[model samples]
Target: MLLALIEDSLEREGWKGVSPMEILEILEREATLRRRGSITPNDVRSVFREVKKARETPVLETLRKNLTFALPKLPVSRHKVKMEEFIAASKNMKLYSDQEKSREIMDAVYLIRPKETRQQIGGLHEIKDRILNQISLAFNPRMAELGYDSNCRFLLLGPPGTGKTLLALVAAAENNVAFIKVRGGELMSGASYHGEPERRIKELFGLARQRSPCILFLDEADAIFWGGDATSNKLLAQIKSELSELTSKDRIVVIATSNKEELIDRATRDRFEPHVYTVPPPQDDDEWNEVVEIHLQKIKPYLAPDVEGRKITRMFRRERILSPRGVAETITEAHRLWASEIAAANEVRAATDQEKRTVALARFRADLERIEHMLPAIK
Candidate 1:
């Protein structure tokens, strides 16, 4: 609380609009951060919108302009190549354009790599196989006409750290498709002049359509699409309408993920073909052991005597902990802390043995607690 008050006082000036990353940093420092997360593509989109709004604020306009100028310019040849590619395709459907968004969508898709596949994504072999097979059929023009009775749409519903987003990433990667992620809550800013969100939706879907064989994923698929607000609901309708019209793999594949599928609208729910529930960590004893072994393999290379980071994972993997994403994050953070220790170590000053022990212990304890919280909600 005292730290929060200090952070609150540290704001530059009155009505200082902050970017989403900055807000997260302050919240983490104040120890007020609550939500567990993997920062799904949807969340990134939401944060992008928030930061866009902050940049548009009059107080920060100059700062935003400066930031844009300081950033390295995107390659010119790539932009022209995408423009030519989209233009060639646009000839088939008169609806496409080379607007601001056409470039944005092209740039976004360009960042997607073919190498991001299910083979690289850890865990869920059976679920991955099932989902992949379904997508494979769905992606084929011949199978869509077979009158298969399956929910064409899917919901990757599960608790935090269960690799829901990772599965979506792998699916897109394997399918050789672009992943267009949209966040629901960030779609609604205010009723007055937030038509921008609606426009963004249209452009996003249009781009998906234009770039056939792409995946449209709504990360927190339940938030704004619910039937509570009139305008926001209409925005969702814009999405469903597009999805309903799309018939083949050539027409963009739709994959939606939500932690809470029950809250999704019944009618809206029908649009999705199969609602696959992601199984969280099992209560079975052996599963957590697998997690520990996988992560400890990564940890072993980074550990040092100064940190006293003896691997507890070698003895036991008792707790049903460490989902694939959890393992990745743990490794990343451990590396970060160790790098900090190395950087902080100098002839001028060194961490006391107790200081290093306290830091190391806190990290290990946090890792265990995260595992505890990530246990599967099933038997």
Candidate 2:
């Protein structure tokens, strides 16, 4: 009842959103509800102050973000912002003093790249067109010339294992900007000395600004930004808070991805309107067929004869074409098997004094057939 009264007081004050103090209060309440130990008062005081400073920190940093999507759209010229300026600006904010933690974050950012960068990233012609179109439409006229508008916010929603995260890496590489990725599970830094999710959220946005023009991609976006998870409300608050600040005058941008859209908080959903949705490789979509072919074409040349035989045989005998991801896996497995067989054949030849390519070829073919049976049928 005490907690309810406090929430009501905030609501009555027109605090439609949660504030740093409110968040701290909620954390204390939650700990009690769960019968967990209480949050330390010292930690609460420290993190709440950090939270206040984070208020002025930019979230959108670019006019193209969803927070400002309703504002007049403008044409964006092609230009990339320099990383140095971004880093210098972050230092001004004094957000990241822990260089070690920042490096760890950056590593995760790089590691999130798609396994097949060339094939997946380069082949996204239509998607690129859509993304560029939005960037053009969403930028501010003057900022576009200054490269601020070049930073864009995009929300990618689609089936599982799709290259949503991979697309982020490709975009970063193509634009030559830092790629930073944050997942819902890893957002917390074990609570500050104050136990608020405050410190990490502040650090995250600060890191993003430092890496401005960079891709801040999230894998399970719904988990972080959706309503219903009292835990997620903190992040949801951070998103609105950041975007509001970024719109005033900054060049940083943000992009997010989620497989489940329905679970997203209304505020987050509103912010990502007009987002691009990535559909799973269609059952019979011609475009998907072409993408599949292109992916296979690139991998075909160096298939190592044994792997080439196994994969090609499976593909030719079966009617289904693998998703770009699936095809890549199939090729890798085929290569390993082929390499093993060649090694065995070379060893046997030392004793038998017989070098026969025909027998080896037949064995590879049989292996291919076995592989064909193991693959699940794609619809």
Candidate 3:
């Protein structure tokens, strides 16, 4: 069990493999093991030598010979020395450090690619500028020298599907920092079931610190921080305290989003009020068009060859406002339609530009109409 836990910790620490020495160090540092007894690195080396010796013992060789007759078969290492080499190579791998931990967090988070940077997002110009400025100040070396370690926290307030999450992603990408996303709803639900709200808070911030200079985005911020009375309120207050402590850690920038700013608890709002930015739905047709155009360009490569952008944009904007997510969905549906046409034709040749446009436009129009009616409030 100890060995399994050590391996698990090593894996979590971004060590795909380990040397005998590393294994020993990991075991010694393991919380599970440290609580029970003292285990030193030197002791680990001694154990490694013992295990190597035991594997090569004459008694083990004799037992191996008898085991063949005692059972159907037994799987055993043919070269015990190979284990030593494997362990040595692992020790040569990158040491576990903040950089390695950051890489692991980057892999786990939903990385916002370069194309999805602030440039791709339409409107929200004020919010975008504010975020970029904060990022600039945070990245500046002078911040540390001046001891101006203010929490670079921002709260995005808006209605659902108003691009709050997208803004967070774009900010992370533009700043060239690791992105760490968490849903407040999930944390709150888990806490309710297990009654470990404080621990959950610690874990979230701990990960952000491990991957310092990263953007920690908490979506649905209101869900976990608001809407609780007496009993649940105490838990909410405790969670808030945990967050309050993290405010001093300038390396981790927290961007939290909520559908309704009012729904956020008064205490929570006051805590993060100075940096809150309201993200409203697209205010006009021009903004909406830009959102559609952004998504259309992304799906264009898969679209019928040489389809005119104007026609596609017109069809998507027949008569409605679409959130960034809605636009993405619409384009995705159109791609499916184009793919289906190709599948049904079973032709060796690709469809002509006109054919692709016609088929895709028709499919997109249908899907858009259905989706608009079904989820009108989302946009």
RMSD of each: 17.7, 19.1, 12.6
Clash pairs detected, candidate 2: 43-193, 43-194, 44-194, 59-242, 59-243, 60-243, 61-246, 226-265
- Candidate 1 lDDT, 1-379, residue by residue in tens: 2222323432422223334334433322222122111112222233333433443455455566667655443222211111232222222221113323533333333223235555554456557678877776666666657865334567777777776766767777776655666565543434245565466567667656544556677677777457667676776677678667766644466777777867787777777755556656433335444454555556676665543222433233433334545655766776776565444333113335766745644545434343344333210
Reference-based lDDT, each prediction: 0.51, 0.50, 0.59
Question: Per-residue lDDT of 228-332 in model 2, one digit per residue for the tens?
Answer: 655566667877676556541334446777778788777776665566466454343444555545555665765535543334535633845445466556656
Best by lDDT: 3
Please give each candidate's TM-score: 0.55, 0.55, 0.60
Per-residue error for 191 in candidate 3, Å, reads: 2.7
Kindly provide the TM-score of model 1 when superposed on the true structure, using C-alpha atoms.
Answer: 0.55
Q: What is the lDDT of residue 15 in candidate 3?
A: 33
Output the better candidate (1/2) by TM-score: 1
* Candidate 1, pairs of clashing residues: 151-273, 151-274, 152-273, 153-272, 153-273
Worst 10 residues of 1 by lDDT: 31-40
- Using lDDT as the measure, what is the rank order of every candidate, best first? 3, 1, 2
How far off is residue 104 in model 2, in Å? 8.2
Model 1 CA RMSD to the hidden true structure, in angstroms: 17.7
Candidate 3 weakest ten by summed lDDT: 31-40
What is the per-residue lDDT of model 3 for residues 1-379, given as tens digits with 9 covering 90 to 100? 2233444434443433345335643433441222312232233334444544554476667787877665433344333243454344333333233223333232334422233577677767657777667755765557777887765677888777778887777767676665667677665563554446655566566666644566788888877777566645766777677568764434667888888677778777766757878887666667766776777777766766767655655665674535666667877887887665544333312336767745644555544444455445322
